[model samples]
Target: MPRILLIDDDAQLGEPLAAYFARFGLELHQATRPSEGLARLREGGFDAVILDVMLPEQDGFAVCRAIRAEGDVPVLMLTARGEVMDRVVGLELGADDYLPKPFEPRELVARITTVLRRRRAVPADARLRFDGLVIDPVTRSVERQGEAVELTGTEFELLLVLAREPGRVFGRDDILNQLRGHEAELYTRAVDIVVSRLRRKLEPLAAIKTLRNAGYALALRPQAHG
Candidate 1:
């Protein structure tokens, strides 16, 4: 059974949602406060997190940042406001996906399932080696300049998509499609945010090059195979 942590302050949402999730072979755990949620996350064993924007103590963005700072546990943010800015902020903070409030529980399940699927999918092949960057899809690890680089799940996926095709300019829409499938509602800014985050993490490497009004491409030269 997949374990999920839902961080929301709604007194009435947890029980029903937990019961609903149980039907799909998912174990749902609830934490009403951000602090409590973070504590539970630290205890580990969570496959994914469902975070709410409106919460007591710290907001969901902060919690998401904290989670990314610690590890690459996939995160799905919930925003009752459903504002575009909210989604953008959440994605920029390293959330893997987001869903608006008043959403169908089944749709929520689908969104969660999609992110979890991406997180667990590992390509069977050799490692990708660039000028100063090395990516191992099998292990989901990245190394830059001989040092291991920690990246969020989404960040790692974004890098892999580009590194796989060096010099290929992928427009924002192209990246969005690759990362989140054909989710038309997902804005292009989400791709920019994730790319920005990935760029910052792989700093001084100068791997990703932005094409003017075009898109982004991996500029790193591939290391020759022996």
Candidate 2:
């Protein structure tokens, strides 16, 4: 069973939600406060996190940043229904996905499944090597110039899509489709935010190239192997 941590201030949301999640073979844990949630995460063993934008102690964005700083645990943010900025800001802070409040329980389960799938996606080859970068699909790890580059689940998936086919320009829709494995009501700018973060992590190498009016491509040439 995949363990998930939910950090929401709603005292009533956790028990029922956890019960519903159990139907899908997911073990859902709850924390009514951000501090409790962060502490549980530090002890590890969670596959993903469900975070609500409105919380006591601090907002969800701050928790997302703290989560990203520590590790690449997959994060699904719960936002105010129809609030675009909430979703955008969560993504920018390295959230793997977002669901609007007042959501159907099944839809939330589906979102969690999608993110977990993306995080555990395995490529055909063992490792992808570029001029100054290396990606090991099995380990879901990346190295830039032989230095380990920690990445969020979404970031790693985006880079995998581009790195798998070097120099192929992927449109925003194309990248989104490949990454999400389904059509979503997300903005194309989401891709740009992820790309920006990825570019920063892969600095000095210019591993990803952007084409105006198009999408992004891997700029690094494959490292020759003997």
Candidate 3:
């Protein structure tokens, strides 16, 4: 069963949605406050989070950003405003998807199912040989020259994005959008931070290449073989 954390102030809406998801074999954990939600996120070991944008105190955007800073859990944002800017901003803030208020329960279930499916579909191949480094995405592990190296969650996601498509020149915005999910807030240096962190971990192998202002790409060293 997939575990879901729902952060919304509207008890009426939350209750019904929780009940609806429960019928589908999902375990829903509800939190009406931002602080409580964050706490649950850290401690509850959930698969995904459904956050309402109009929460008291910090709001959903802040909560989402904070969570992104910690891990890459899929986040689905719910906003009553339904404005394009709001949707864009939510994507820029690292939310996986966004749904406007007054949405159908079925639609919510569908979105949740889609996100979970994508997350689970990430391949478990023992090793991804990119450039000179080998990455095991399933285990969150990496190896260079037959030696293991440590990487943080953000670094691993960044590397996974680039290595998944070698020679592809992904723009910073595109990389950020991909790794952070569709609903991340735009930041001038967010991609740079992730890249910089990745570089530090990959420096030993020097497989990842920066494409000047275009973005970053992964290229295998001529002599390095799988």
Candidate 4:
């Protein structure tokens, strides 16, 4: 069973969602406070996180950014505000997906299923080596010039897709579909944000490249470490 962490303040929502998720072999853990949520997350057994946008004290945006900075645990933002700008902000903060509030429980289940599925689908013995950079999909770890590089779940996934087919250009749409497993309402900038974050962490050995009027690609090899 996949374990999920739900960081929302409402027991009304959590009670039903928990019961619904149970039917699908999912274990739901609830945290009503941001601090508590972060604590539970630090314990490290969750497959994905469902965060509410209107949490008390710190809003979901701050919470999401903090979570992304720590690691790439998948996040699905739940919000009563369904504006495009709100969705864009959530995506930019490294959320894997966003679902508007008052949504069907079934839709929430589907989104959770997609994010978790994407997390597990990796090639066997899945390792990629490029010049001074090394990526092991099985371990979900990266190293640059023999030093370990910490990557969030989303950032790692993005890099894996690019590294899998080095030199092959992947448009934003292709990457979105590859990560989310569906045609989503994601702005192209979402891909850009993940790429930018990955680039910062994979620096010096910089293997990712951009194409004008095209898309992004991983260089066949990174620059030799000095």
Candidate 5:
């Protein structure tokens, strides 16, 4: 069973959703306040999180950052129907997916499954495929649209990091530690520079998306065969 945590002020939504979720073997836990929600999350053991954009205490973005700082848990943000900025900010802040309000409960379940499906505990092989983009970690190679995309060692590692978990956002410091095993420098723009260079090589295929004030994530996958 997947244990899903809901951080929202609407206590009314819990019982019904919990009952509805139970049919699929999902256990639902609700926390109305961000502080309490964070505490519960810190206690651990949640398959995914459903966070509301509007909260009593800290907003969902802050909560999302805190969650991402701890680990790569799949987060699906609930936002207003037209809050374009909120959705962008949420994604930038490491939200695995987002659900605008006025949605059917079944749609929420579908979104949760979609995000989780992209995340596998172990790759079936060293080759990772997202749509038409293929990354072979063993060979340290990347291919797009039947052509090769050459990347620097750092760039390849960075791409590999983001591609490992398609929708998970990675902060600059996290990338630094993974790539160079050190802290990020205040004056350094190395990560940005590398990303820019990489973007050039990976043209026509929008594989990476930048999350401003946060980091980056892999957005595009290889297209499926007809």
Candidate 6:
């Protein structure tokens, strides 16, 4: 059974959600305090986490960043705010997905399942090679043209997103949502920052072009037609 840690101060919602998840075969562990939740995470062996944005001591974004610094466990953040900034901030902090408040229990289940599916789909081979660049998803390492290139987790994920859909122009919001593991943020240039960082690393091999207010595109040079 997949084990999940749910951290939410809202007992009214958390209680019922815990019961609902149990019926789906997930082993649910609930923590109403941020400290307790972080402790449980450190104890290890959790398949995923459902973290609420609002908390008593520490906010969910802080917790998300803390966990991300330690590991890549899939995180699905819960927020009653539903504002674009809230969603964006959560994603920037590395939450895998976000669901607004008043959501149906069934929808939560679906999101959890989706995150798990993506995790399972990630290549076991730690390294991915495309053209001249090599990416190690596990260590979050990247190499281009036989040279090691440093990339932040978000930058690496952004590259992976674009490479996975070659020739596709990913708008800022789409790219944000993809790497964010959830919704887009409002009035934040996180995606732009990620792109700028990625471009610097990719410049030695390929060109990462901006589409004039549209978003970004990684244009692969045409192979010589022999």
The candidate that achieves the highest lDDT relative to the unseen native structure: 2
Q: In order, how many clashes per candidate?
A: 0, 0, 14, 2, 8, 1
- Candidate 4 residue-wise lDDT, 72-114, digit = tens: 8999999775576667788778788889877888888988998
Encode model 1's per-residue lDDT on 124-183: one tens digit a residue: 778999888889998999999999998888898899999888999999999888888785
> For candidate 1, which ten residues in a row score worst on lDDT?
180-189
Model 6, TM vs. native: 0.71
Model 5 accuracy (lDDT, Cα) = 0.76
Candidate 1 error regions (>4 Å): none
Would you estimate the TM-scores of all the predictions?
0.94, 0.96, 0.65, 0.87, 0.59, 0.71
lDDT of each: 0.88, 0.91, 0.76, 0.84, 0.76, 0.74
Encode model 3's per-residue lDDT on 1-226: one tens digit a residue: 9999989987777777778999998888789899998888888589999988888998788998888888778888898753766666676666766788878888788878867865676575556775467787777678877788765444667778887777788898897677545554555465665566567666766667788879788866433334
Superior candidate under TM-score, 4 versus 6: 4
Superposed Cα deviation of residue 226, candidate 2 (Å): 7.6
Clashing pairs in 4: 72-152, 72-153
Point out where model 6 deviates above 4 Å.
Answer: 122-127, 130-132, 136-158, 165-167, 171-207, 219-226
lDDT of 2: 0.91
Show where candidate 5 strays beyond 4 Å: 127-226
Candidates 2 and 4: which is better by lDDT?
2
Candidate 5: Cα lDDT at 41 = 85
lDDT per residue (tens digit) for residues 50-131 in model 6 = 9988899989999888887777788888987547688777866666677888688888887887677656555555455666
Ranking by lDDT: 2, 1, 4, 5, 3, 6
Among all windows of 10 consecutive residues in model 3, the one with the lowest summed lDDT is 217-226
